[model samples]
Target: MSLGDENDGGQTRTRLPDGGTGDVYGGARRPARNSRSLITVVGVVVLLIAAIAFANRSGTGEGTSDDTAKGPGAGAPTSATGVRPVTGKDGTIPTGYAHDEQGAQSAAANYAVALGSDGMFKRDTRHTIVRAVHDPAVVDSLLASLDQAYSGTFLKNVGLNEDGSSPEGLTFVSRTVPVGTKVTGFEGDTATIEVWCTGLVGLAGEGSNKPVTETWFTITQKLKWTQSDWKIQSSSQQEGPTPVNGDNRASTADEIAGAVAGYGGFTYAR
Candidate 1:
C-alpha cells in the first residue's frame, strides 16, 4: 500500500491533490507541474470508474428484480391481515386468534377493547372477561387485584353507581377504539404486543353530570399461545401516543347516548 512520498526541501511532503505542491520549510509554496496534474486527474477518473463497476456488480441486473418484495401496506396507516377474523367467543371476549404474530397482535387489540369496554366496570362481566381472555393460572389473582382497583370510588368518578351501574335515565358509556397494534416481541409460544387506543367514557343523557369524553392510551400485553390460541399472560397500560384534539364540536349528552345505542361495535383483527 505504499504510494511513495515526495521530497520537498529535505522534508517529506505528501503530494497535494489537483496539481498543487508546497514546500513547507518556512511558507513558500509552488504549483505542481502540468504532468503531475494530469496524473492526478487520471487517477481520480480510474477510481471513479472502479467504484461504478463495483456498484454495478453488486446490484441486480437491469431487468431483474425481487418478485417477492412487499408493498407499503405493511406499515400503512390502516392495514388488515386479510385473513378471516376470529368468530369464536368465550362469552363476550373474542377467542381463537391465529397462532402466529398476526394472531398475537389481533388478540392483543381485541383484548384491549374488551378490557376497556363498559362491561369491565360491572363485577359479573369483568369476571367473565378475566376468565375468558386471561390464562387460567392468573385468573383468580387477577380478578382479585382488579376488584380492588375498580373500587366504589373509582366507579363513582367515572359517573357510575356504587355497584358500577348507571343511575335512572342516565347512560354509562365506556368504549375503546384501537388505533393500531404492534408486536414488540415474539417467540415459539410467547409474544408481547402493544395496542394504541382511544377511549370514550362517562355518562351520556339528559342532565348527566358527566359527559362522554375521549382519552388515549396504550396497553402492553404478554401473551401465551395456549389451547391453539393466544391468551393474555400479563398486561399493563400507560397513557398514550396521543394526538392533538380536533376541531369538531362536542356532541350533547343526549346525542352521544343516542349514538351509542344506535351503533354497534365491530370485531377487530389484524
Candidate 2:
C-alpha cells in the first residue's frame, strides 16, 4: 500500500511507504562511529563554540542607545504582557487569535504542532484537527488528501495498527515542538509564516523495529483571516536547519514511553 505521489493546489505530496523501510529511521540501530566521524564532530563543536564566543563579544555594549533600540529592526526587549493564551477551543485545538501579526505567528506555531501530532494518524482525530486549523474553503479537500496520506497501509509502514493505534505493550509517538516562528508576510487579512520545529516520530517498545527518533523540519503556512480568526489556507514543509547531534545517551524504550505519558504538550503564544 502506497500513498502515490500527487499534487494538490501546487503542493507536492509524495508517496509514503507501505513497508518498514530503513528510510524513515535510517536503520534500526545507530551506525558505528569511525575516527573520521569523531574528528568531524569535534570540529563542528569547536566551530560552534567559537561562533558563540564571537556573538557574545559583539553583543556587549555599555548600554543600548535609545535611537538604536526604538525601531522594529532594533533589538526590542520582550516582557510579559500579562495576557493569557486564547481560551477558545476548536475540538481541543486553540482558537481566537488577536487578529494581528503576533496572532498570525501564534496561529502558525500552534497549527504546525497540531498538524505534526500523532492525532493526525487516526481518522477521527485527523478530521477534527484539519477542520479546526484549516480554512473552510480548503477543509474538506485537505481532509480527503490527509485521509489518503494516513491510510492504513501508511500507518502500518510506521509500525502502527491498521486503525493507527499502537500495538499492545508498545507506544507510538509523533509530536512536533516548535522552536521558533517568523512571519514573512502579513497584509490585509493574509499572512505567511514559517515555523521551525523538532519532532519525535516512531514506536517505542522492545522488539520494535521503528524506535522513536528525532527529526527537524520547518513548516511554512499561508494563512487567511476568516470567520474572525486566522486559518491555514495552504502549507508546505521541508527538511530542516538541523544541528549536529550531541553526545547524550539514547534512552530506553520504556523510558521514552513513560516520558511521553507523564508530560503534556503546551499551547504556544507569541
Candidate 3:
C-alpha cells in the first residue's frame, strides 16, 4: 500500500496546488486552545476534542485523514511510469499519449509536468496546461475552478509578486524535471503514474529578491485515455521520502541566479 513509491493501492486525490478543501484538511483552521489549567486540562482536552469531532464531523481527530496532509495516500501506487515525457511529437506537447496502461502512465507523467511547473502560476499558461492535460469533458469546469484557485494569496505565498506575476527584472518559474517514471497498474483504461521529480520554483534575478528554492516532489497522476490522447482526471503530490544527499557543493547565488535567468526553458522530451 505504498503510494507513489513504485507499487499499488487506492485512488489519489487531485487538488488545486493552493485552494479548496483537501481530504488532508491541511488548510483548515486549528481549534482555539482552552484556557483551562495544565495537566488535567491536557488529558481531558483530548477526549473532549474527540467527542466534539464525533459531533461535528470536522477535522477533530488525528486519524488517517489528518495524517494524509503530511504524506501520500496509504492506498496509492508505486509505479515507475511517472518519470519522463513521451517523445517524438511535433514539440507540441501531448503528441502521442498511448491508449492502454502504458499510455495512461505517460499521460500522467506529462500532466504532472504540466501541473507542477511554473506554467500553472500564470493565467494564460494555466489555461494551456489545463486544456493540454485534462479530460476534455471536464476541462471547462476545471478551468473555471483553477482560475479561482490561483488566488492572489496563493501566488504571494509561492514567492511570486502580489499580482501572481513575477517582479520586474525577475522571472518567476517553476518547472518539474521528471527524474523517472514507473507504472504501477494498467487495468483497462484507468492507469497510475508516479513521477519522481525535482522542481525549480522561485524568483530569478540578480541581487533582486526572493532567490529560487528547489524542492523534490513526487506526483501521481491517474489518467484515462480519451479521444486519442491521455488526460488527467485526478492527481496529487507529496514531499519526498527522498534519498540521502550527495556532498555536492552548493552553487553560488550568482551561478544559480544566472542559470535561472539566462537559461531558456525547454518543452521537455522523452
User: Quick one: best lDDT, which candidate?
Assistant: 2
Whose TM-score is greatest here? 2
Model 2 TM-score relative to the real fold: 0.73
Candidate 1 per-residue lDDT, tens place, 153-177, comes to 7566555788989989877776677
| Per-residue lDDT of 6 in model 1 | 14
Give a tens-digit lDDT track for model 2, residues 1-270. 111112233433222212332333323344432223111111111110011000000012243323122212232223321134566788767788767655666677777677667777788987887788878987776666666666677567667899989998878877777666656677869877666667676776655566666656666677899999898777666556688777666776667778888988654433
* Regions of model 2 farther than 4 Å from truth: 1-83
Residue 192 shift from truth in candidate 1, angstroms: 0.8
How many residue pairs clash (N, CA or C atoms closer than 3 angstroms) in each of the candidate models, in the order given?
A: 1, 0, 16
Tens-digit per-residue lDDT, 1-270, candidate 3: 123221222323211122112121122332222212111211110110111000001122243222111122222233232223345452345545545444554456555655666656678877876777667876776677666656686566555765577866666766656665555555567666566766565555554334454455566566676766666665555556466555455454456657776776545434
Off by over 4 Å in 3: 1-91
Could you arrange the candidates by lDDT from highest to lowest?
2, 1, 3
Candidate with more favorable, higher lDDT: 1 or 2: 2
The candidate with the higher lDDT, 1 or 3, is: 1
TM-scores for all predictions: 0.69, 0.73, 0.63
| lDDT of every model, 2 decimals | 0.55, 0.57, 0.48
34, model 1: CA deviation in Å?
A: 73
Q: lDDT of candidate 2?
A: 0.57
